[model samples]
Target: MSNVKDTTKANNQLIYAKRNMWTGILFGFGIVAFIDEAVFHQLLHWHHFYDKSTTEIGLVSDGLFHAFSFFATIGSSFLLADLHRRHAFWLKRWIGGIFLGAGVFQLYDGIIQHKLMRLHQIRYHVDVFPYDLVWNITAVIMIVIGIVLLYRTQS
Candidate 1:
């Protein structure tokens, strides 16, 4: 009946909205990663921000990997979102877990690799920096927010 049709339409709209939101989030993060690695590191030569010389190259490589992963994940999310619209509990759980893991890894890397070990410098140079704390806090906030979103989005 009309009630059944209306319910189906509403469900379809909800699925579309959820898929679009995730797609936007993934693409936004991917773009940020690309800018950090490609534009900032490769093109601008902004200090690799790491202590170990060898690991400097690895940092850039990791950035690239992150960019590619983000894109791939986004693509997969869209496909899975479409296919699992009606039965998305498992899919949501898996994606949420992945995001949680990635966020934790980034948090650890930022603290130990970047801050504790003093492998990487914050600014492009050793000169006095005004907004260093801001940058660091922002990174921490992003990691926390990512984890929270992942946890909340999971069924």
Candidate 2:
């Protein structure tokens, strides 16, 4: 019974060590979503969330996307706050997690939304292949960096 308890405690400690990375991933995802909306959708006016729909619908879609991302950011903040309270926060792992999350989000948008769903491309009136190529490749690179950082994080 003591051995079993020891194993359980060890497992919990291991999980705690990786918690920052996971939380950072969540924060990264939300931040990327916000940046996407700000840059592509609003700032550049390259494309809306759903270009196939009416303009008003497209605006609404963007709003919903913002709301979702906002909620994700908020949720991650709560978890991070708890970790901070416990003095378990590890900044490096958290940042790596953010990178992982952002990379994953970008990759998904580039692959699934851009290629698979046939949604709006990166930008209109542009040579899409280069944009797609660059976008996915960059995302992969970011993900690799994130993986390396998280793996090398001190326990």
Give all candidates' CA lDDT scores. 0.53, 0.85
Residue-level lDDT tens digits of model 1 in 1-155: 99986677555545554553455345444444555556545676655534366765757665656567567557756755664555432334344444433444445445675667865554445662444555556556665665566566532
Instruction: Indicate the worst ten consecutive residues by lDDT in candidate 1.
Output: 87-96
As for candidate 1, its clashing pairs are 49-120, 50-119, 50-120, 51-119, 51-120
Best by TM-score: 2
Candidate 2 lDDT tens digits, 60-135: 9899988978988998999898877666677778888998999999999999988789677888887889988988
Instruction: Give all candidate RMSDs, comma-separated.
Output: 6.4, 5.3
- TM-score for all models, in order of appearance: 0.46, 0.87
Specify the highest-lDDT model's number: 2
